[model samples]
Target chain A: MKVKIKSNAFLIAVSAVILGLLAGGLLMMSIGSNPFEGFYYLFRGGLMNMERIGNTISTAITLMLVGLSVAFAFKTGLFNIGAAGQMLVGGLCATLVAHYVFIPRPFYLVVIIFCAFLGGALWGVIPGILKAKFNVHEVVATIMMNWIAYWSIYYFVPAYLKGPSLETESKSIAIGQTLRSPWLTGIFGGGYINLGIFVAIAAVFVIKYVLDKTTLGFELKAVGSNRFCAEYAGIKVNRNVVISMMIAGGLAGLAGMAYYTGYSRNIQIGVMPSMGFDGIAVALLGASNPIGVLFSALFFGMLQSGKGFMNAMTEVPPEIADTIIATIIYFTATSVLFSRFWDSVGRRKRDKAQQKSDQDESKEEVSHE
Target chain B: MNNTTTKQSLFTSPLGIAIYIVVGLVLLAVMATNHLIGMILPYAIAYTIPLLMTALGGLYSERSGVTNLGLEGLMLVGYFASALTINLTEQTLQASALPLGLLAGVLAGALFSMLHAFASINLKADQVISGTAINMLASALTVYLARTIAGSGNVRIMLGIVRRDIPGLSKIPGIGTLFFTQSYWSTWVALIVWGASWFLLYKTSFGLRLRACGEHPSAVASAGVNVYGMRYFGVGMSGALAGLGGSIILITYSGEFNGTVAGLGFLSIAALIFGQWKPLGILGATFFFGTATTIANVSQVIPQLGVIPPVIFKVFPYVVTLLALIVFSKRSAAPKAVGEAF
Candidate 1:
């Protein structure tokens, strides 16, 4: 059973990659870009050299965090469109802690990340509490909260934390606090890849552990699978729902830290990055699994990082990347229907084999008689 | 039988009076904040009217069981198209083109929203994903088209429609001056849409059929109603109204097009949900948000409170929106079949 489940997961991952590639190819064709050249450049631009590879991996780290946040919600049957909002809030909070909160060197790093996580979790909890207690749709709640987050970040960053100058941004955090890849420099010859990537990897393991090996995970899975059953079984399903949302929100917030502190080198947030929302697509494509999220995030990161190369290599507008991503998302949204169709086909084949075996046994009995 | 009845009654929900109370208190608070109240209140009213108009459109689609999530995208197209049409036609008429623009907005928005309806109703695509496509398509297409038509990303309405001043009400000492004076055709359109929607949703057989299609399409189909047609009608109406809202926004708020539609369409969705999918409730939500948003933007006028930074005040509306969403989602009962497709 374990082997079968593992193989099925593998198949789904492979199919998702193929679907993404095919969709990208079709988009390139529509835009008159040569697929081969486009893809070649995509690879070359994102991973051709150590520096390029490091940048891609750094981006993937953040993407993976947000992607996992989205997947966590999906696992619990909540569509968290507020990953963007949560990330913004998280970024804001992480910035506050890193800049204002006094702490030691490496310990401060963990504290700031935690602060980001808490900020995101708080934002997420608003929507979760609504959904759990009031039966409000998280979709609408999250969307609205995103605007609040925008204004909050806008006001807080510019007004309260403005440096000695009148600049809209805050004072830059000390260089010691910002994430860098000192450890990975030995391996990749001083690339941009940082400890954040390791954090991302560690997150995947933790999510897997919490989900597959814990009682809390069991309760969450039960509630997600069917609220009525969980409720009837005397579980506080609504609480678990809220908890799941908090976890999801926290993960997304960490994504913001990975993005702002690690990659952008600034604590200030202006526009809601598409990364938060794109995580939804990534989560969906990964089928809401932690390991799947890791790969899907990498894939999406590579695509984004490769857009410049793709544009240069072909007449295909770089905008084709967005079109392809959107198209793949469209397909992924319908994946539930596809899975249903596939399952029915499998069931039918099994039924036919069972009937044949029964007939064969009856004939053997008659021959024996 | 008595025991069973009691058990059933325990499950039966209470009326959502708390929503009204919270909404009322929030409005009163906005009104009470004297320094910032003047700017925020009018802005909120102006913004709310159009958004409420769009939410009515959403109410129709959702009540009919197909979620029109592409509303934001459709509104963007509506906004740009209305701007272009008004600008182009006004060149010939010089002034009457504003009303003409509203008409054009409705038509263009209807046309765009049909694409969303077709994808969901015909292709059976997930409504959320379909909405996302429409949104992206609208965003990209609007930017491209607006640039092409206006010869720039920004299109200035040469002679924009001025807000009509109500003589008696505009003279009212303080609050009346803001709410009643110099309102756009959108305010009238919003009221009319609200009335017409109320009538259509509750009084007409078509609305009943639409609701049936949304809640239980299979049953409605068995009852001899065309589920697809009803859903299309609901969604199409939603698109047209959202378009009108978008156009109104372009003409009144920004006086031009600069992707200023921002995320109002999505906000309208929030209003729809916050309003609990009811026309009256949606109106209140629209007004509430519009007021809060307007107050946040204009509260910078008072130098004393200005020290607090206007952004903090700007957070009020969103906080309320979040509160309302939490309050409503948990308590208010949605239409029996809100997101389910017919």
Candidate 2:
């Protein structure tokens, strides 16, 4: 009854990953493919060449930022499902800047980055305001916001940002206007490598410092842990909610910029980025921790980058990776099942240690007598 | 405060909103000079039926205290199931294939919802997270299976319901022209289901207990009602209705299950909220959205609507939903214990 074992989140997360992989393996077997062979090609596909590795890293950058957005809002106990909307807004802003805003090279990048973040923040703040002021459910509000963003882009892109002949996408920015650099591109063997890598890495460090070292992080976490308790502690709960959503939105905006300007050349109309949804899985698998998110995003990035090669070699279909990721999400969602099983194991260990200590004490008494 | 002024607006009241919705729609009908609302009524009804059924599905689960974000996934499952059934049977069964396909969809949805029910009810998992998982799983699995079976990710059916006017009902004057003429039979089926659902949820003792489970589970439990069983029923109903909704889409206008219900599931959630969780409200709200959507779709081809940007019509419903959220925020009719992991 007195078992004081802490439920280890790390172990729980790892087990879920293993179970998810096993389920994916089972699915492969059901489909008449050898799971071992499927995995072999899958791993090789991601790391087969310098260019492929660069592609993988580029994919990871967008994922990491989106994951961070979800994780940040998650910490404040707000579900920022509108990351997709924020991404669209951010991508639109970055694309517009790249098209018209000519400035000194170094300053141009800063303006684009800031503009993207600001745009995303604008997209995110509405639901936050609705939740804070009117008590609207963020989920429904965000879903509505997503479609609004979707239709807005569907109209806005063709009318204002259309390329000379193409009606569905924005005019491609020149290499000078984009996030690409000659050195990075050379090192990556001219893959989609860009300055976004540095941005993602810098973001990792900044988020880590904020979460571990700052009062704002503490307040956000406090609100997440218990909203009324945080209010009792004299924290302004509503203000923190809005701030958290804004920052989360800003991060997702950065992800959009990373994708549109750094990864791809231009924004495509009528497509809501799937990374916004995938980021939820990344955040869940990482247990909403920044470092954990970075690693998981990298892992997902590998699966996405390798998918085509795996598909060609094994004919197992690209959706196999999605199936695995989805299964992982399901397992994480049922984490309550894992928590109970681990706690019982933890309790048994504590029982053995206590028993051994009691026997040693008895023997010492006997010697004293 | 702006809130106070907004409160004084006529549309804030439910009756006012309903009247405004009808009047506003009538204005659109009147303005489209030389156009027959009858010519457009069938398409509008087609769009409204799916949303109506799905939102009704949502109505069940939410009133029983489970926030079902997975209705989209459930609908997809039904969509796939019906498509597979029809694709297999269409050659042999011919006209008979449609009803069997619909049955398959309903059954598949109910069975699939057990995953959600087990997670939320027995495992006591977070309902929203579990629902999200359901969505992810459905999307990947349906497409994967479709790719395997169809050799392509899309499943197509050659057969669809033929639109016709009702014999006696079409003879009536103004009302018949709008409601009965050039209609798919599924429209009446949907209306019947709506009427039945209203009775079941509001009048029956089973309905009372199920609703009470959402409001106060412990109180219901003390009254000797098995709360878990009631919730299971609620979720099951949602799954079945959503499946019906999805199947209707396939057998009517779509004639193919290419997956991706284009976010109709979430839109249905919006309609449910805008409808204020009542059957009548849902009917009105979905119809309004259906009208808005139909206008957006057909307006691109029509000359007069081209003057106003199609995007305006396309984005109208979603924007109005946000406004409705703001107006309805104070007296939200959301189930008292909805989304709580009880």
lDDT digits (tens) for residues B1-60 of candidate 1: 133442243245233345446557756765566655655555677778778878888998
Error of 2 at B8 (Å): 9.1
Clashing pairs in 2: none
lDDT at position A193, candidate 1 = 71
Candidate 2 docking classification: medium
lDDT digits (tens) for residues A1-369 of candidate 2:
001112476777788888877887887788888998988888788888898899999989999999999888888888878899999999889988998999998899899999999999999999989888877778889888889999999989888878887888988989888888899999989888889998888888898889879999999888887889999999999999889888999999999999999999999987889889888888888888898899999999898888788889985877888878888887787787888888888888999889888889999999999
Residue lDDT tens for model 1, A1-369: 000122355455555466767866765555455788878887787888877777788878888999889777766777788888898888778777767777776788789878889999999998888788777777777887788888777767776677666465666766566666556755666645767887789989999898899988888877777778889999898899899999999998988888777776564546767788678767766767898888888877777777777667665555445555555565555454445556788899999899899889999999999
- TM-scores of the models, in the given order? 0.83, 0.94
List candidate 1 stretches off by more than 4 Å: A1-44, A100-105, A163-166, A183-192, A309-319, A336-369, B1-42, B83-108, B111-126, B129-159, B165-181, B255-260, B303-309
Runs off by more than 4 Å, candidate 2: A1-7, A353-369, B1-34
Which candidate should be chosen as best, given TM-score against the real structure? 2
TM-score of chain B of 2: 0.93
TM-score of chain A of 2: 0.93
C-alpha RMSD over true interface residues, each candidate = 6.0, 5.5
